[model samples]
Target: MNGMHRLLWAFLVAAGLAGGLAGCASTSSTPSVGVGPDGKVQNPVQLLGQLPLPPGAAIRAEQSLIIGAGDNWVGRVVLDVGRDFDAAYRFFLETYPAQGWTVVSAVRGKNSFMVMTRQERTATFEMVDGGMLAGSVVSMTMAPRNAAVMVPKKP
Candidate 1:
């Protein structure tokens, strides 16, 4: 077509692109939803009022889900421990009891596991060592504590 028509067509295409991008951009009145701008829980005390988390641990929200809130929460919370596996392992070993969790079972290795109980609930920790660079991943699952089952003695 003529130069004037081509110029008008280019301007229209640029305006359309700008409008589309503006539509895609989101602006919120608040700083964040459930988490802070940094993706960490905005209020850990409100979310995990009772449970103790390792220092500097980042919650993997995409991989984590919970029911209830605060001290009554249940479900799995996957954490990216910014330290090595041993550190994360010890953090739970030390913190759980300090928070009133009685250790039912604890095993340490390349892939560690620990089970703890408090009041009417139980927590299971599945830990994995992610080598030197990747740090460790701690998957904590909390549920209601079960009643003990009796077993017969062997003759």
Candidate 2:
């Protein structure tokens, strides 16, 4: 694999995504996914429920929110990983798919980005070199897949 690809996987490692790197071998694997026992996945931006982040992931509490929407819940958490860009990038690339998410688009380099979807959930990830601290900043935004679908055109 190329350097970019390796880093994405490293992100998985340093990000503390459960699956091992070997499990990421088949990027083509398509596993079934659905809402958790709570009726829905609390984390829309991540591949699975609130992922177990690396040792130093500090969640920006004031910026996060979980609100009730009818019988469902909507929320987002802004977390920063205390690692270099490569390590965190690799974490998501490998972890998301292993958890049953389909990667829609992925770009790994100085400025990295990943967009993935699973069932009615969609997550957009961005890794930047600088943020609140000296390490890399991982901004993950998640929402319902239907939230961004195009409106049907009139016949």
Candidate 3:
């Protein structure tokens, strides 16, 4: 009976060691991007960086709008580009803040980014595409408790 007890103890120790080694070996090397409650990426640009973009396309213009109550802000960014929507979107998301902007939420398929704000207001900007294509438009909208308000400028 003593010999059987010793064998079970050895087996438990070996299993524990194997599990620890496996856990260490499975550690992820890729940096973590923002993820939603469901474990899917919450930022589209981050996900775009992981995918391939279209060819010979450039971003032409980008705009952002911020609106909300005090301490509660919603931001929206629109991208105007020539062709490579994916790359342009990623670039705007990764670079715009360097020019003084904050990104709140980013959705890739829709081609837009939401900015968080402390005040209630809307801001917009433009970027020149310079590519052969005439123009492409991308819009982003964010609402903390209600739908975002977007108003088109009169031509």
Candidate 1 residue-wise lDDT, 20-133, digit = tens: 476468562322327767666655555565787888888877787655456866667888887567777888999889878899999888899999999898888999998998
Q: List, residue by residue over 1-155, the lDDT tens digit for candidate 3.
A: 46543443354345446645765787654344554464333344432332222233322222343232122323443444455555566665656565455665555453244443223422232233334565555443333332233343558
Candidate 2 lDDT tens digits, 1-155: 76543544344334333233434664755334344453433334343245545445655545554332221324454666765667677778888788888999999776688999878877788777664357776767655666433333558
The ten-residue window of minimal lDDT in model 2 covers: 65-74
Question: Model 3 misses residue 34 by how many Å?
Answer: 41
lDDT order of candidates, top first: 1, 2, 3
The parts of candidate 3 lying over 4 Å away from their true place are 1-80, 110-113, 116-135, 139-155
TM-score of 1: 0.68
* Number of clashing pairs per prediction, in order: 0, 10, 6
Q: Give the distance in Å from residue 65's predicted Cα in candidate 1 to where it truly belongs.
A: 1.0
